[model samples]
Target: MIWNEHIECMDREQIEKLQSQRLCEMVERVYYNVPFYRKKMQVLGLEIGDIKGIEDLHKLPFTTKDDLRENYPFGMFAVPMSQVVRVHASSGTTGLPTVVGYTRNDLSNWSEIVARALYGAGVSKEDRIQNSYGYGLFTGGLGLHGGAEKVGATILPLSGGNTRKQIQSLVDFEPTAISCTPSYLLYLAETLKEEELLDKIKLRVAILGAEPWTENMRKEIEKQLNIKAIDIYGLSEIMGPGVSFECINQCGSHIAEDHFIPEIIDPKTLKPLPRGSEGELVFTTITKEALPLFRYRTKDLSSLIYETCECGRTSVRMTKITGRTDDMLIIRGVNVFPSQIESALLEIGETQPHYMIYVDRVNNLDTLEVWVEVDEKFFSDEIKQLEALTRKITKQIVNIIGISVKVKLVEPKTILRSEGKAKRVVDRRHI
Candidate 1:
């Protein structure tokens, strides 16, 4: 079931050797071609020769989102604009967008890694894939499209939005696989149920990412849609949606270590953490030609597993992302993440996966309020019963997140649906 066994299932020592060689070459390329990287290395009194192998990766300065912003547009690109064949940019909600470039070889490699990801999800050429990720400046759509084509699978290039058309194509095309954000998939499932077309479609595997989702939510997706849900992790700064993926076994997502070296580091101290310790996930793209990044901090929180998987891939695996360090919210001296609230709500089983967290300062005290969408069945319940359910959810949140939260049980579909990454938090204190 493995694809590109030479790289995915290579011996651990051999894999490290390959990574070491690639790392050395990448460091040299950035040192000479990228002034930003060269200045950072020179400031540390380090040279290309100093980075001999993967062992010396720690010596290299970490690349942050702010660093990418400072460079802006094509400034971070290692190759000339003529050599770059493709460009993708982040939404840049905070400020200037981080732009990434890809050479011809980089695109091919991106396709290959995405192909490997599809294969790990039990996809085959016989299966038709519906790519629902956004297209254009976003990487998810084209990333999955190229990967599906690389795998020799038929592709339906139906990007995000157009819910009616998305469902129509699903039933008409009867695609066997789908790739999109998990929340969007849930919305699609709701649409299918509403239109009474769930049985008409033939979707088997869902490759979901672009947002951090909980396992409880996955089970709900599986139950509602009657399909196997697999998590795929990627960011636009890297190669896109094919960075890593979950196999059918679903133990952990196997990293494409040959192209991107994975590292877990303590976000606060910036020191490498031991394997299996939950910390910030970092990546260094050694195989990229147009834009080779050194120790790019992803801000995602996850642990790494180096043991061989039952699926027989020797590539290291990463646990499901818990949350982003930057996304963590401190309310009333308690650290909270939206994912924790999601996990708590989904664990309760009576509410839908759709929920929102609102944080504000009330009377100079930080307060947290959670708005949860309840199933239609719950809406018909007695008024007292609904109040009891709200109390129950409040207790669960307090127990799980160690903070008191006011729970509001709203009607289903009341929460705004997103075609891309879901907006789960609304911090009003800043306003």
Candidate 2:
């Protein structure tokens, strides 16, 4: 299922050589076309000719989201509006949205990379895919849609929400694959079970991304939906959902190094870490035509692996993202990630996957409370049983995260379900 085997499985030497050439060209393109990048390079005492290859990538100045916002619309674009054919942007909760543009060639290349991602996740023309990601401004829908088209798969463009229609399409269309956020997939599973349509559909593969999910969550999704759950990694700031993807082996997600060069660096020191060392992930777009970025800091924490995968793709792979540095919750001076809590809850195997973390300040001290859902059958048990379960959960979380948390057990379907990325935390301390 490896698309573009020649590039995906290229030798390390060939890959680096091709990357070096593209990197040099990208540097030159941005230097003359984008003033922001040119100024950043000049400030760092760099010229277009100075960047000869990917080896000198570390010397280039890193681009941040603030830089994009400071420039506002189209300032980061390397090509003029006449040559740009499409534009995609991140969902900016505050201030202006980060803007990105694409040339005709850029969109075409985007399709191919997304196709490679879908192929890596075992999608093909024979499969009917139900894409549940949203359309319009959101990159997830169009990104997955283009890739599905490139793979020649039958597409049911049922963008996110409307659980009833999604289930109806699943039963009626009988799609063999699906794409959506992992949490939304779980929500869909719940609805399908309620409607008794889980067995009517024929889904064998799920291309899930948009947020960090743990292995336990993957297993829960697979077990509930009766499908192979594969993780796809990407960002609108970089490329949508096709940056990298896991092969059937599921060892790690193989990065498309021939296009996007990835580097893991210590977030504190801003120094590149050796492979397998966890740090902030950074990417440089060497093939993008409309908007070329130099060492864009993704702020995601993950390590890389260069060992050729069992899938036979020589493209270097990244481990599952632990969490975003911005998303880390510091409670009582101890750092914790929502994914870690989800993993612990799933490993305990005593409650449903639906849960939420509440962080607040009590008497000037940070407090953490975890609300978990239990099956109705168990929830209706004697008071002592629920109390024991609560104690067990509190103990388990403290043991794993090194922070004492008040555990609240609730009935099934109490917490709101999300058809997109699940909102896992309610931090009122800032408010």
RMSD of each: 12.1, 12.2
lDDT of 2 by residue, 13-95 (tens): 99999999999988888889898888888888898888888889999999887788887788888887999888887633232
Off by over 4 Å in 2: 327-431
Residue pairs in collision within model 1: none
Cα-based RMSD of candidate 1: 12.1
The parts of candidate 1 lying over 4 Å away from their true place are 328-431
Q: On residues 1-431, what C-alpha lDDT tens digit does candidate 1 reach at each position?
A: 88898899999999999999999999988888999999998899998888889999999999987788888888889999999999998643233457899999999999999999999998989999999887887788899999999999999999977888899899999999999877678778988888898899999999988766678869978998899999988887889988999999998999999999999999999999987899999999999999899999988889999999999999999999876778766454234667778877778888888999998766434679999988986675588888899999999878777657899877789999988989999987542
TM-score of each: 0.78, 0.78
